[model samples]
Target chain A: MKILVPVKQAALVEDDFELRDDGRDVDPDFVDLQLNEWDDYSLETALQLKESHDGIEVVAVTVGDDDAEDALRTCLAKGADRAIRVWDDELGDADPVVIARVLAAVAQRETPDLVLAGTQSSDLGFSATGVAMATFMGWPHAAVVVALDYSPGAATATVERELEGGLRQRLEIDCPAVLTIQLGINTPRYASLRGIKQARSLPVEELTPEDLGLEAQDVGEQACGARVRKMYLPEKGQAEMIEGTPAQQAERIAAIVKEVMGG
Target chain B: MGADRALESGKAVMGGETVEPQTLIGRLLARPDAYAAAGLLAAHPDFADHRLLRMALPDRATGLVFAGMRFSPACLLEELGGWQDSAVQRRLAGNPATPAPVIARLLDNSSADPDVGPRLAAHVRTPTDALPGLVADGRLATRVAAAGHPGAGHGLLLELAGRGEMPVLRVLSARADLSTALLARIWERGDRHVQAELLRAATCPRQLLAAAAHAPHALWRRRAAGHPALPEPVRWRLLRDSDARVRAAVAEAPTTPVELLHRFQADPAQRVRIALARRQDLPPSWLDSLARQPGAWLQRWVARNPCCPRQMLERLAQSAAAEVRRAVSRNPATSAFMLARLAADADPWVRAGAAGRADLYPSVLARLADDTEVDVLGAVAANPSTPAERLAGLAMHDDRDVRRAVAQNPAASAAVLAPLATDPYPLNRFVVSQRDALSLATLEALAGDPEPRIRFIAWKRLGALAASH
Candidate 1:
């Protein structure tokens, strides 16, 4: 059985400075660095299943420019058997539902028995991507999996979906299916020294929607399910830190209390 | 020798053998000798901000020394009353005698300082007449309570067995050291807002019992019965109290003398009589009296606790309270003559408690299960001796709590649990979910249960079942 894993990356370090959109009208540098926290869990789940099931092969896939290839390469280095890069330079501001269409088109070529993705990409965090992908593929989906089990005839997993009001409950569903894993599932194994060396030699299959019998017209901002009308920081006020001797500070605190109490 | 200069020097000397800055502050903070520190403060204007200097002068006598030092009153107020660790206030309140001048200074200047909330609260015990309302509010209560001196720590504490004065006891009780004093205090004014503090202080059983025992009045004796660890005094009173709660408190008393229980059985309170009927070692005559009981209430209570003296129930079958008579009728342990007596009872709960036993009569529990009163039905539902088939049948009767009781019974079968599986209350579902008797299929049925709490328990149970494999 083959399993397909999609990996997304973001910068490891937070950039303290404001983002500057380069001439392409995109912040290429942000995409040019690091991995998303959620996608890392999805990547690990696939790798672990392949390690335990001798015949299974895990493939890492992504859809972005050359910078994203660095992230896919990182996945391969971690133990994925192969890498697939779907180069799409114009898809930066695309939403999840559209991205899901693109991803499903690419994934059709692999004919994987099961597909794994993160519950949500931290950078975009639509959280609708995996569900959209499952709908597009017409496969049963179980999300936020905390545990998994895979045997030939029956593959099942237990997941805890976060619900309204900070509540969580477990759910189970059969797989040969799509499963989006929440963060901190199984610990992701790091690339071994030998694995890293072997990863450098692995094949990367390059594809586009055209290669998968799809059109670019099926994606981009037009095909997106939602719209972001504005982006700006919310107004904030500075926090005051009162300083004085303990007694003086205490007195101030007491005075505040007195005024509040109207004493 | 220059006598004039010598006299000036005597008064101006900053430190002496017994009055070194450190010892003087430490001792003065600890005793009435605090006058020593006061004296020092009087001498030195700079020492008010001198926390170290005041601390170093350890004795209370040094309050005077502090006063003598002309310490800046502003700074002394700052060091003494600043929100700080208990060690700071503990040192001050521990002073057997506080310097009157310093206290005077506090009263005069307490409101003058900005941090007067905690400071004024801290000194509430300083014998000032102008306290109550200022001390009662939240800010002061929390700060003063937190700044509580060690001896005062016993205010609300349940375990303090010491015989201190009422004020000290009040202080201890406030801190959650629930004891006789607290109970008595609660008893006296427990009906009023005074109970708010006691309620806050003693939520636990031992403390509740101790507090109840010491509760000042009979009303608290009944109130104490509503809570845990029956207070000894409340227990003693409940052995004769008119209220069911009081009697229930007596029934829970681990050391209740059988003789006291005997006298309690004859008390005017029917609830007391009902309570006495539930005990295991009730005298034979008590069972005899129950046999003739006319009321269904007596029989229901009797049947719920089946081990009581059988002879009294035999005699109680003839009581006017239909419930009591029903109790005599439903008793399985009742003799043939006893059954004959209870069979004539007007109330069904009484008959149900004394009804047909295999030894003399058929299980009358079935008849009582159909009684009109919800209370009797509840009695049958709670009675362990009721036949499993009969109990299962009652699981569907309208009351959800009775159904809950039936569902929770160890003897309840799968057939009985299936209907309750659809119970609206999560409590009933939780009971059905937890019973080992419920198969994995039942748990699966509850997996999609609407109540998250129930669903959570079901999931946990499923996980445990999965792990055993």
Candidate 2:
């Protein structure tokens, strides 16, 4: 069995970041790129499944820039059998739908038994990618899966999905399905020194739209299903801090309460 | 059809300008301690005239039922039984006035929503006979709720402890009635996670602690080391445990002898030494030496320690590391002169930290209020020591955060806050509503403000004030 996991490197913006002079977006210099927190769980889930099953393989895939290779290397070091990065200038500004289309094209080529993705990325947070990809592939999908048990012989996977208000729904899905992993399903293991050294020597496969037999126009901004018209920081609220000496403040509060309550 | 016709006829009898009788009656029935009115409304002869029965009761009626209002409890129960909303059923289960038979029916209805079962089991009035079934329910949350239920019997708690799920075990451990035998069963059957939790419980038996002291899991060993009841020999053994985390936990434990704590002050691991540095009970003489250490991190911790000599904070205020300086800036023990000096530091974060201290002189705050950094200005606006005049100036600052901080400053007088009460941002108005010191006039104005949330807060404050009086 082979499992395909989609990983992403999301930007961690500082709390105090300010918009650029034009006020369109935050200044890029203040942003630190790191692994998307949710994708870390997805990758860990795939690795755990591989560890339990005999003759099973895990492939880590991403659609990102050169810097994103760091996340792919981390995946390889953690036990993924292979890494693939899909990059193209046209895909730079791609929306979740466009990214899902590109990943679907790769899935067609890889033809893995299952696809795993994070429930949502920390940055952008478009939770539509995995479900849309599953729809594109005509496969059953479940999101926010907290528990999973699969039997290769039976070709069936039992999963527990987290619902709002602490409710859970148990589902049994057929193979060749997509499952978006939720956090806290398992504690992700760190990459050992030996794994890190081995990862450096592994060649990461790079692909583009052309390699997938697609033109630039096939996955461009025009192909995007949605667009972000504007972005701005939310307004900040103030917390009223009571002042005066402890005794004075207490007395004043008492008087105010009396006035309001009409003693 | 008859009810609709009656409602139309009642509407015709009342002028359109006036509130419909049904709406007024529903509101009255929703009031707290309105049991008599509720009973009267329920028993009204005319179907249309009986507003409570004529109109579909709003969701707020659920809260009134749960508020111990005994007016027509049977009628409310009947009305709730006809509704399919699980939320209403959950409320019914919580209402102490709810009759025992209704609760029993809710329990027996297998098709009832999953959430209702746990609430029923946890209800204070639930019979002991019904608890065991709910405790064994397949849903983990229901089982957890049952285990934590105050009325859970010993047998039910023992069953949950035997289940060995971490959540269930943790809740069972909190019960004062949990027998030693049950604790032992949980300790033996539980996985490493459960064992760690058990070690942390104040009620952990001595036998469990001794056994856990030798557990292979370092987390369990580390937690055991911190147990206040651990034998002295076990504590000493854990101090030298192979894991640094265990040694750190032991070093931080107040039960550790002062002599041992002093020896850990120089441990190779910074975490151990840092833990020692944070102990307020550490001899002041030793604190001097720890302060002299070359590590800036150690100096930062010493600067923040409550027992650190004032002289030490003054000295660390000039350190080259912005972090050390920042730590001193926030330390209450730091002298006013040192805080003023740090407020002008090249690093904006250090200055911002200094700007937030209440002890800073008004002159220093005025200077900080003019700093080029918006965060420093924001800090000044938030400081209680900031003069009302300075707050008035900042309330109109271009930076919305600075203005917000000014609006929130408790020191701002009514004159300073009046303009902000109508500030363009609703959040600013919302902040004004939270001030307990606001004049009654201001709160009354905010109570009628356009924003629903602001109005709600102002009204809540008004209600609290009226009740207090």
Candidate 3:
């Protein structure tokens, strides 16, 4: 069995940020990079699957620069058998769609029996990459999956998905599918010293668009269906505070409710 | 057709020497593993022309060997052109042995089976020119794939970023390589949620900060006030803001002025006052007053404050609230005499807190080690200040936790930890595995323990010691 999990490296803004002189974006110096929290859960799920099954190869892939390699190394330390980093200069401004395309390309090469991805990224919260990857693969997919059980002999998987308003839906699907995992499906384990030491020597295969038979013009910014136009803070609103002794405040509140009711 | 007769008749002359079989099929029949024979036969150059071999081969064997076999671009294209099985086509599409032309043909064939679309889309060999059409495809998945395509054009990205939907904006925001101009535009048009995210960027523009400072959502305002880049004047305004929570956020800002911290000390909200009390810069005199306050929570904060004066700690040691006294006992600044006094407090919790202190006098630790309360004794066993003699004594305690604590103590003598090396509980044995003072002989003994977990730690510690040498 082969499982492919796509991980992302997200940047978090530090409390102190200074905009560039151009007034266009925050200075790069102030951003702190980390693995997306949701992807951490996704990696944990894949590792857990590998633990329960024999001869299961788990591969972790990501689309980012060198910083993303750190995240892949972390996955390796946590028990992923291999790591692939798909990066191209043209993909720097690529949107989620472009990212899914790159991932699909890698998936095609690997032909994993199962693919697991975080439901959403911490930075963008698009909640669409995994679904889109499944779509591109033309495979059955389930989102926000909180529980999973796979029957290898039957090549079927039963999954429980968390829905809005505390609802849950359980569905069974055939193998070779994508499951966008939600948090709390399993507890992620910390990488032990031995694992870290071993991971330092593990080779991470790096692929470019050319290696994937993709051209820059094919998956660059031009292929992105959407782009961010502008970002700004919302206007602040004022709250009305009822200030007085308990009795006076109560009287004021009653008068207001009575006025609305009478009107 | 008898097996014996077939074997006897299989010999033939070939290449001027005696051969097992003259015909390929005949040769395959003589092999022990027919599948291995078929795989080898499938790779032979002349096998394509052998009608009998093609007929004799199973589809699974043909597909597996073909997928794994090397083929020129021209041959792969011709084979793929005639391939009808979706599964086989998918295999052909993914095989690196398959030439680029074949992959391109599959990618460009709009009329191909729907299953072919994803395989082609995912094929690294697929042409980059196909990404734009896929990105604009009617299917949501294909469109998404194109969005992530490394070959996606800039115009397409600009269009996606223009969408008002959160999903589209989220995709756009994740682009670390986005141009500053595009990022600014996204920031301007983003809703409050998007705006809040932009504010989290290390390079958040001043304009965004100004806008967030007055955002309709107090949450946004609070976040903006917490920004390290927040202008001094803007922070001052937020300091006087009506919302206590926002004011509290400002108080928490590292750059918040000392004068403002002093002024906020009088804030009517207890949360705001608590936030102020936590600041290391808070005047010691103020801590003195707060320590005397009637609120147990406030006094508790003062007790935990490292900046809290020794005089204030002395006052807090006598606190009526057990929690406050415990905090005082835990303070590293507490005098040895005060720790001894607290170690004998009527409340077991205060005594336990003192027992855990590393600075407590050895004599005080010995007294606490004999406390009737199990928790106090356990804490004493764990304290580094506990004398080695006391540790050896405490190691014999009947309670597992107390004994476990003795095993974990860094100051425990070899004599104290030797018995625990073979303790009944695995956890006690595990703790003994971590003691630095253990002899190499003891660690070697543990390495052969019955429990695999104990052996693992014992080996790890042994490895660390070996590396140190």
Query: How many clashing residue pairs, candidate 3?
Result: 50
Query: How much of the true A–B contact set does each candidate keep?
Result: 0.00, 0.00, 0.00
> Model 2, range B1-469, lDDT digits (tens) per residue?
0111111111221223233334434444464223323333333332123344433244543333332334333555656655665555666775666777777777776345776777777776678788888755688888887877788887777777777787787677656565677777787777666668778777787777787678878888988888888888788788777788888888788888878766676778877778888887888778888878789998888878878778878778878888888988988778898888998899998999999999998788888988989989999999989988888888877776788898778677766676566565667777876664555556556655655456545544443333222
Model 3 regions lying over 4 Å from their true place: A1-263, B1-194, B413-415, B434-437, B449-451, B460-469
lDDT of 3 by residue, A1-263 (tens): 78999999887764434444555455555455777889899999888878877888999999998889988988887799999999888887788988998899899999999999999998789999999999988999999999999854458899999999999999998878999999999877656445666887999999997798777776887889987655445599755577668999999889888987995
Q: What level of docking quality does candidate 3 show?
A: incorrect
lDDT of 1 by residue, B227-299 (tens): 5445556566556555566676566544676676766655666766776777777666675576446566756
lDDT of each: 0.57, 0.74, 0.72
Tens-place lDDT per residue, model 3, B283-392, is 88877766665689978888988888888888889888999999999887888889989998999999999999998887888788778899899998998888888888
Question: iRMS value of model 2?
Answer: 26.4
Report the C-alpha displacement of residue B146, candidate 1, in angstroms. 40
Listed in order, each prediction's TM-score against the native is 0.33, 0.52, 0.42
Chain A TM-score per candidate? Answer: 0.80, 0.87, 0.89
Which residue pairs in candidate 2 collide? Answer: A261-B466
lDDT of 2 by residue, A60-124 (tens): 99998898998898899889999999999888668898888888888999999999999999988
- How does model 2 fare in lDDT? 0.74
